[model samples]
Each structure stands twice: as C-alpha cells, then as structure tokens.
Target: MDDRTAEYLVYLDATLTEIAGLARRGRDAYDRDIAVSRACQYNLIRLTADLERLGSDWLAHHPDIPWRLIKGMRNRIAHDYLTIDDDIIWAVVEHHATQLHHALENEIATAKTTLHTDEQTP
Candidate 1:
C-alpha cells in the first residue's frame, strides 16, 4: 500500500475503534439515545469517505471487504437521512464493525511491514 492508502487504513481503523466503543454501550442505549445513533452514523460516514480515498484499485485487491455495500450505506446516510434505519446501523455496529476493524488492523500491520522491507531492500 502507498502512504495515502496506509494513512486511510489507519484512519478507518481508528474510526472503527470509535464505533466499537459506541457499540459497547449496548442496544437499549443506542435505541434510546439519538446521540449514540448519530455518532455511529458520523463514524460510518467517515469510514466510507476514507475508504473511497484508498482508491478503487486498492479496494479491488480486497474483495472480501464489502466496498459497494459500505459506499451504498454512506450514500443512504448522506443523502437520505430520514430513511436511515436504526436497526441496520445497530446491526452493523454490533455485528460487523469489530470484524472489519480486525481486518483493517491486519492490513495496516502488513503495510508497515512491507514499507519496512522495501526500505531495507535498497
């Protein structure tokens, strides 16, 4: 990964961490607290924007990540806020965010190792 891609991945990972913290607050609080929901949405938007910065080629290399769905969710959140469903956002936070965070962590570590190896190769 290039520096920009690596930077985006790091940012995404941190955003995921924020989402994970929000998720730890549990479902009832998420459902009752508008703040929590909005926070989750904001972080998700951040994730999508950063992911887009990674570029399509970088994204294509990781087919396992649901790039289209993620972008789609961002579009929905950005363009149609009223129609945004709490259940789906909650599901993403509770079920998917951690897994994605782990994936991003691994990717960031790999990128660092690759950069280190490249520096030593010359």
Candidate 2:
C-alpha cells in the first residue's frame, strides 16, 4: 500500500481505538469529562480527513464496511461542527465502535497484503 493509504487507515484505526477506550470509562459521567471529549473530537477530525482525502472510490471497493455512514459522520463533524451533539458522540462510542473496529482491521490487513505484494514486485 502507498503511504497515504496506510496513513489514512492508521488514522481510522487510531480513532476507533480512541472511541473504544472512551467507552470503557462508562457513559454516565463520561459525557462530562473534558479529556474524553477532546479525545472524541480529535479522532472525529482524523477520520473525517481520511474519508475526505481518500474520496468515495476507495470506500466503494470496501463496502463490506460502513464506509458511507462513516463518511456521513465525517461530514457532520466537518460541515456542521458548530451543531455537534455530544449525545451522538456518546452513542457512537457505545454502539458503533465495535463495528468500525472490525471493518478497519480487515481494511488494514488488506493494505498490508498489498504492501507486501508491491515490495516483492520490485
């Protein structure tokens, strides 16, 4: 895989990890924690950029994942930042985190395979 692709996937992976880590803290008090909010925002931005920069084509081939909804989340974060609802973030952490993690793990494994093939070709 090219560096850009790998980097984006890493961004996606890291964001997923951040969300899961946040979920472990439990949700009731988590919504009020400043640190947790920052981590949530940070990953949202990272994943947003990854989707925006990579565009829909890459995601199309990877439709086994929720690429479209993920892109929509990024859109909400990027285009509607001022109206972001903390409750939505909380919901994502609680519900969507596991699915995204599994999807990204598969994507990353495929990228690694591509990287290995490219290395052998030269």
Candidate 3:
C-alpha cells in the first residue's frame, strides 16, 4: 500500500469510530431523531469516500467486503437524502457497520505490518 492508501485507511477507521458513536443511541432513537440519523449518514458517506480513495486496486485485495453495496449506499445517501429510510440505515448501522469496522481495523494492522516489513527490507 502507498502513503495515500494508508492515510485513507486511518481516515476510514476514524470515521467508523464516529459512526459508531452516533449509532449508539439505538434504532428507535435514530428513527425518531433526524440529527442522529444525519450524523450516522454523514460518517457513512465519509467512510465510503475514503474507501473509494483507496481505489480499485486496494479494494480488489478485499473481495469479500461488500464494496459495491457500500458505495451504492453512499450514493443513495448522498443523492437521495430526502427519501433516506431510517430503518434501512439503522439496519446498516446495527449490523453491517460493525463488521466493516472490524475488517478495516484488521486490514489496517496488516497493511502497517507489511509496510514496516517492506521498509526493513534492504
């Protein structure tokens, strides 16, 4: 991984943290409160953009991740904000988001170790 990919991974991880914080209020609260929903959506959008910045090459290595669906959700959240359904978004927050966050954390650690090994190689 190059410097930009590493940086973007950090950003994604941080954004995931923020999303997690925003989502802790539970689905009922999120569905009832537009502010909570907006915060989660905003972080999720940032997360998708950061992943996109990592580009197709980086994404290819993690084929198991639902990259396309994530990007599609980002598009829907961005382009169709007015019709954004709280239930679906909350479902993503409660289920998919945690899985993605953990996966990204593991990937970031692996990438850092790989980079460290690469640097040590003469």
Across 3-93, the per-residue lDDT of candidate 3 in tens digits comes to 5676677777778778777778888778788788888898778888888888898889889889888888899999988887777788788
Q: 60 in model 1: Cα distance from truth in Å?
A: 0.5
- Candidate with top TM-score is 1
* Candidate scoring better on TM-score of 2 and 3: 3
TM-score of 1: 0.86
lDDT of 1 by residue, 25-74 (tens): 99999889989989999988998987888889888888988988998899
Lowest-scoring 10 consecutive residues by lDDT in candidate 3?
110-119
Q: Which regions of candidate 1 are displaced past 4 Å?
A: 111-122
lDDT of 1 at 87: 92
Candidate closest to the true structure, highest lDDT: 1
Error of 2 at 29 (Å): 3.9
Question: What's each prediction's TM-score?
Answer: 0.86, 0.69, 0.82
Q: Order of candidates by lDDT, top first? A: 1, 3, 2
When 1 and 2 are scored with lDDT, the better candidate is: 1
Decide which is better by lDDT, 1 or 3.
1
